[model samples]
Target: MTITALRTPRRLVRVRKAVTRRFARALTGDAGMSTVEYAVGTIAAAAFGAVLYTVVSGDSIPDALGGIIERALNTRV
Candidate 1:
């Protein structure tokens, strides 16, 4: 075999090993969200819930929902 042919397989093997190592590292890495991220997410979710509750608990929403329910109940089957 020629020198180039021998070097070709060795280079391919080295490249394959490097790619495998990188892929394995990427899979097993501790690349998750941190505590600060969790706190921010929690605060954001709470604020959203509060806003949603305030909107739903307003007088107009309840009155509209009650009117809908009354109309539905009064509809003849």
Candidate 2:
């Protein structure tokens, strides 16, 4: 390609400026959540964690885990 082809012209410069302005506005725009959204997200995450913890530490899980450990310890290794 020629050097002129690689060089940006006025139209390309205008286009680049437009795109940069658009991107700037988009970045600074309210595309994210407010404080209430953050609070809600935190609460949801905490609730999900609690549920996971409850399911993992349930009676059947503990019994199964204790049986595995007991067998492992009693094995004549």
Candidate 3:
């Protein structure tokens, strides 16, 4: 194998070790990280679930929203 190819894996391993150490330290130092992660993940999952529910229900929310906007714009005071 070429020098570049042989050295790539070694370099990647060292970088991975460094990253893992840092992540471990950060997790230990930050007591609220787990809670923050859970909150963010829950919010993301809920958003995804809502979108999936809307799609699976065959509801055209975007179209309905657009129609409402168009109606409001076309209506006179």
Predicted model with the maximum lDDT: 1
Question: Which residue runs of candidate 2 sit more than 4 Å off their true CA positions?
Answer: 1-15, 22-33
Residue-level lDDT for 28 in candidate 2: 93
| Each model's total of backbone clashes | 0, 0, 0
lDDT of 2 by residue, 4-77 (tens): 77676866999999999999999999978999999999999999999999989889888999999999999996
Best by TM-score: 1
Stretches of model 1 off by over 4 angstroms after superposition: 1-22
Give each model's whole-structure lDDT. Answer: 0.96, 0.93, 0.90
Q: Write the residue-wise lDDT of candidate 3 on 1-77 in tens digits.
A: 89999999999999999999999998889655587799999999999999899786665877788899999999999
Stretches off by above 4 angstroms in model 3 are 30-77
Model 2 scores a TM of 0.52
Residue 25, model 3, lDDT: 95
* C-alpha RMSD for every candidate: 4.0, 4.8, 12.5
Task: Report residue 19 deviation for candidate 2 (angstroms).
Answer: 4.9
- lDDT per residue for candidate 1 within 9-49, as digits (tens), equals 99999999999999999999988889999999999999999
